[model samples]
Target chain A: MSEAALLVESLAYEYPDGNLALHDVSLRIERGERVALLGPNGSGKTTLVKHLNGILAGNSGSVSVDGVRVDLQNKDSLRRIRSSVGVVFQDPDDQLFMPTVREDVAFGPFNMGARGEELDLVVKDALERVGMWELRDRPPHHLSFGQRRRVAVATVLSMSPKILVLDEPSSNLDPASRRELADILRGLDITLLMVTHDLPYALELCERSLVLAGGHVVADSRTREILRDTDLLSRHRLELPLGFRVD
Target chain B: MIRPNEDPLKHPISDHHHGHDFGERLVLHRHSIVHHLEPQVKILAMFLFIIVCVATPIHFWQAFVVYGLLVLGTILIAQLPLNVVARRSLIELPFVFFAIMMPIFGSGERVEVLGVSLSRLGIESGASILVKGTFGVLCAVCLSATTPAREILRGLERLRLPNLLVQIVSFMIRYVNVVSDEMARMKIARLSRGFEAQGVRSWRFLANVAGALFIRSYERGERVYLAMLSRGYSGKLPDTGHGSAGIRQWAQGLLLPVLALLVLAMTNIWMSR
Candidate 1:
């Protein structure tokens, strides 16, 4: 594996309406590093994640996975980047577009040319990993929000990505589901880029974190260290719930 | 940092939630032979059966009787709910009523029945349409009632239907409920704030709701596409599951349509005399 699993240098993106979503954002995540991308809403976290897979090509700067640059306009590089860097969107419904859970989970693998028994094995392993194997044949919309979220993870996991990026993963999940997902996420051995507002979740699962505000990487340090900085957290619109403190 | 009770053991996302049957009404009588048949075979059989029924000349009235028996027998074999099927087929009521009107407006030779004059050609054409249309609707309802929407889409894809058309139908089946839920929530939000939607002027609000739904759906399309692209979707849906149907399965499914075809032939021969 390359030493620098993901590298973003001075990335800047401006929407068609002239609103800048990301500005001078630089990040480097080493291989096997579990890092949290913490930021407020509209803080360029998602914009930066989109650039990782070349989904959105910024106006300037470059993003590379495993040292190979991601050219958003090039089909071959974009395909390589997307296949290696799997992103699980916040809305499971948006990603789980296939008819059944099995098909949805198998979608990525099959798209990459997996067929028949091999595809079934990939799907089975992914579903079983997420504890959704029993419900593989079920339609996604029939499940609750919590169950669908797990299936969404399986959809990407089946691709066997080298880097997993989750956007707002724990939002709207119940406490039990949240804990369950955190555990599942921690157990996976891969480079993780989690963009989340849940500080407690970030503390539990991610060791390193970068705080983004106004489209810049304002702080990069240990998760615990960032949480201890009360002024930094507050200024970026992040908070710890009552009775909780960073020791 | 403030640590949670680090014991992941306390978190229990039980498997109980999957037990609830959401689409049971759509896939009722799941154990029936008809339910087990391949979706492509079922679709082809239904198409052929309807074609045979519609092509039968009105003079072959006896063929309609046979077609009706074939449908009723299949319904019984499939163990489908008669009342539900009949109620669902009520969608054809307006068209049936239109067929009923054909006798009145149809310009044809006049006939006297019970001291009332009626068009003879109108009676013949109207009755044929009613008989053919009702049976055709019954066959369709039986197919849908037995098959899940998912399998039907897969079946269409397997049968070499244009992938785009099949995908459109698949997305429609998947999100028809989601969009409706959004609309429902919007209505509830409006109602909670004391917006009564009961007047000629209320149509303006309804129009706005429609406009918002369209815009949201358009945006949702983009997100879904991005999601698809993220998963390496390259303008085509991969088909890696669902093998071709067995010959035995096809033979079993074609029995209904084949019997109907035979009825059509018999009626043609008899009416020729």
Candidate 2:
């Protein structure tokens, strides 16, 4: 196989208050792979994804993205790394921060110094990708929650990152919106690490799954294998949705 | 596990339409002259008037009257309901009123007024202060009611107000109501639990609530900042170009206020001499 897009060696993190968030984690993601980080509440799924973009420094282990080590010494490299890895935060309210949808989408490109027509093109393209081109003028506060979430995705997509990290991509989406998100995710060619509790969604979009429990990766295997293992899921405090049956 | 359909936190204050007529609340008619002026003109005029009012000595009673007439004329010309301005001004008046009362309690010459012995110097200084503060507050209320908050920030931006300050104010204006709504819901929850602050120990609960609110706000701010950064928000704010207070609008807006202030100043000068 080609070189891994991201490689983590014994990654660990502990909060200043002495709460261990992640412990001795090692994972490797190949280019263009779609993986789901599955865990119950407080499982350090978010902490691991944050390290992918250099947003948070790992306490012990090193994280390298496509051979570039994410470290504090290279401020310019960190910006470039963050730009290369688009993180769509779980909360739309947290992701869609601009007054208008168009501006919010334009923000990432603009920060990377894209200006004038180039920036406009990026904004329009990204908004169109999420089917939010028409709502470009509407304030995010006025949009439905699902629409806002789509705009949040557009905000990062405009940056054209090589890796897309989505936290709880389907948490608050309605059926129609979730389907739309799935379609969008399936169409994208970039490597993706989606952290979510939605088991069915993971099965539909991600081929591989990493199960985290108490800040440790308890199980990592093919998505179908992990889902079929009822005993492993119970140990990790994850349950299949009611009426969900795998034949 | 709570089914997706049955998340209690999703609908904390369920049925927002139950009693509140949000549509009616939003469609308030503010016909005040300040409202009609282009936002930029109103912002500039208000700023200038506030500066003059604040800088003028308390003993400059005539200047205060001119400022009052200018404000009152703007209110009448804008055709905004007087009751709205009066009601909104109350929020600001209490603080000034409290400050104005200090001179009354301080040592001063004794005098009789309405069969009560009061300090003559105290009343004089206090009355002057009351007049200065009232006109200032009225001007602010009229300006706010006339210009929508977003447009006000835009106007400030056009007036060359620091972008950071205007952006901060814009964010506050947009989010303060949201934060307040959250606090109100929290208060309702606390009330439903029969929690009441009775003593120092009870204040600990209040402190905890405050701490929780602060943490929530801080986390929200981080998310907001990240969102902003994601959207190409560098250090500078975007130029939306909605605030266009041109020369004609500026002329129309300033004419009456300037004329009134001029007439008042002349009358005051004549009276003083």
Candidate 3:
């Protein structure tokens, strides 16, 4: 827990269409910090997290997970990064692609060569964490959107990741499910970096938050401070709910 | 199920349907005899049984009768609806049509029946095709009807089918409905904007929809790949380590094939004698 769990140094990325999705972005997240990435649409939040797990190699600069550099060119390094950092994408439909929820959760640990009771325990524990143990046998398609979202989180949790990188984890969930999910995340012990538009959620869960806009880290400070800054919030096209108070 | 909004009619796009469920197709009717058997054993047994029925000589029409009865017995044990058996066999309709024309097109020894003369060899071939086709289709339908698609994929994995093919099929079963649901939503979106499928102009609009769907699906494929990659996926999906079947389960699965093989062996010997 002493080491910086995730380190992004001077990262920059541009899409194939020549649009810069990330520009000189850099941040350090220590182990056990639940940091929220706050940004408007097209502000490169997704692009930034994709770089953390080596899914999208940056054009310049680097990302390191627990002291090991994330390089897609190196097979061993990429695998190490993937096992250490699990990216929970916005859409559960995309993440939970396996035929059954059990298999989907088993996928990560299974890939890491876990088997038999060990593998079973990993899947069971992960599902139990998200309150989805009963639905393990059910197909991901058969699950409702909220249920699918929870199962999607379990899919990564099964990997026993040191860091959970979620991209818009609360996008399509109902209000109750969203609250339940926030509670679930709060109870977990691992380091969490969640990208979300849910401002109140950010304040409720994360202590420190990073705001990215126009492919750069505009602000990195306390979640409450960022929310209270009406000037910064309005500049980024971010809005708090009507009559909602941070107090 | 908390209603996300007070007025259900005015919901956001986030309320989009996650699944279409593909309707009643893969539903498991519980407590059936065939459902109790392991999927891998059932798969191999059905394949071998179909082969045995197909390999029996056309000269011995009685063997076809016996094979049909065996399939019927298995269907009865499965508790599947009789109409389902018949309706699912519509897959063989084109083959049946071809078999129907066999007597008219081919030249062979002649035989008279009901004021019309047909070639004896052609009639024999047609009957053989019909019997073989029906038995094969019946066996496949039974296997699928008894086992869910997910179990079948697991069974395929156990059978040592190519890993890549198994994965392709597994994903297809999972996402076939999701893709179709996306298409349905796209149709609704267009319809809501005053678009209607009329005569000539509809094709271009439909083509554009297909193009857009292709792009969206391509993007989704990238995301799914990323998800897989994030979960430590290498070139191959690691071994499941859970497909081990017990001896009794194997025996139960193999019972059908062993019986069919016995029938075929007896018929082959009797025909030669």
Candidate 4:
């Protein structure tokens, strides 16, 4: 059988302050799956996502990307896991730290030892994918928020990871930009784990969804069914937009 | 002077959108030989020019004239807007103020002009400082106007600047706007809640705002670090592998400095004669 794209087994994490952020969390995502991670404020969703690529190591249990275990002690394993599981941060300002869009997109592949024409092509392809090729030379600060968001996605996409984990991909975007981003995400064929509070967005993009609250997996089911279940959502402090009906 | 309706914090972004000239501050985004030259080459040449200007004696007024001509010639060649260069060079105003005070306060042989007595030696020294300072400021303005900030940092990197320092400056350039935007938002939030600064009493509140900004920035630094690690950044900054300056490019860039040096040599020789 093919290995799962992302696997977490009995994971638990605690902050440096000794506060438990996650406990006994486990899930397996098959290849080419689009999964939405849903939760309210401070519900360990970010904690779980951080563990996926060893950004935050849990006190117990494990995370494996494409059957390769995330080992903080092993530098090579960490590097491999990092490149395999691309994490696009919530703030484009955080992700696109490089001066120019092209350089920001090239940063990941360049770190991976891609150089010369190969590096140029990688940057070009990534920028083109996001329709930001023409603005590659523009500084990140000069771009509009939506354009910056697209470039942020390109920054990770250039790495061509096995699994792409996005933190609130649709947050703070205007309607047209939202639709455009949705179209771009839909066009790509890869494993996606999106952490979002945008219920309608989840329902539109993801088939399966995982709900975490109070440091545990409160619900794991299909996105449509989960959204339809008001009792299950309200219990975990999830709310859909007013007058929004699930068709 | 902020307008009553205008928040000073919101000025930068709006200024950016309204005028492309204000987007990158000193950078003019022009296409000229000066702009096209390699950054390190430009850096070295400008450095040489400034050094030669500074080394010249104040009595070499003819040399100063030539230097002024050279600067004017460069501005013409670079097609840089004269008003922009003049405005940016206003950064040297403090020195100008000091120079103005020199003739009045300095102790030397007295001279009278327009019913006022001033030290002759002080006048000469003050003029010297003003001339040299103006040239220095103008040269710097020219360089910055031609080259973008990122290229300047890259040039510094290629010139073997410490990677950590270069990275710090790089992050500063990238995040200055973001940080300022955050500060602006915080100020707006405060103002919306009817907070007003009325004197010494407001100093404490402003200090609190600064403290909050510091904490926010610190947290952002951590998040940015994690984001860096997530992208395979392991201590070493990845080299972008931009090509270095060739001999022809170097020769082209050095022409201005070489000419200025020759002018200095001639001025010294003439003075000795």
On lDDT, the leading prediction is 4
Candidate 3 chain B, poorest ten consecutive residues by summed lDDT: B10-19
Give stretches of model 2 more than 4 Å off.
A1-5, A16-20, A30-32, A133-140, A174-177, A187-189, A214-221, B1-40, B53-69, B76-79, B92-127, B155-171, B199-201, B222-245, B249-257, B268-273
Best-to-worst lDDT order: 4, 1, 3, 2
Taking the tens digit of each residue's C-alpha lDDT, what string does model 3 give over A68-119?
8989899987887899998898989999888889989999999987898999
Scanning candidate 1 chain A in windows of ten residues, the lowest lDDT window is A1-10
lDDT of each residue in B1-273, candidate 1, tens digit only? 343333221112121112123233456755888888998999999999999988988878889888888899989989988997887688678778878787777787988878877788988898988988898888878887898777788789888899889889888777766665676677668778987665567678778977998998988888999999999998887774556799999999999889999988878888887
Q: DockQ for all models, in order? A: 0.73, 0.30, 0.80, 0.83
lDDT, residue A224, model 2: 93
Writing each residue's lDDT as its tens digit, candidate 4 over A1-247 gives 8899999999999999999999899898999999999999899988888898888889999999999999999999898898899898889899988888888898899888899999999889888888999999999888888898999889988999999999999999999999899888888888999999999999989999999888888889999999999999999999999999986
Error of 1 at A136 (Å): 0.6
Interface RMSD of 3: 1.1
Q: Compared with the real two-chain complex, what DockQ does model 3 have? A: 0.80
Model 4 clash count equals 0
What docking class should model 1 receive?
medium
Candidate 3, which segments miss by more than 4 Å at Cα?
Answer: B1-24, B198-202
Model 4 chain A: which ten-residue window has the lowest total lDDT? A95-104
- Candidate 2: tens digits of C-alpha lDDT, residues A1-247: 6667888899999988898999999988889899999999899998887788776787899988777888756877777777877889988877766567987787788778888888889989999998899999876667888898888888888899877889999998899999998998898878998899899999999999999888888888999999999999998889899999766
Question: How high is the lDDT of residue A23 in model 2?
Answer: 96
* Sliding window of 10 residues with minimal summed lDDT for model 4 chain B: B14-23
Please, what are the lDDT tens digits per residue for candidate 4 over residues B78-164? 999899889878878878988998899889788997989998988999999999999888888898889888888888888888999
Who is ahead in lDDT, 1 or 3? Answer: 1
Tell me which of candidates 2 and 3 scores higher on lDDT.
3
Model 2, C-alpha of A238: deviation from truth (Å): 1.8
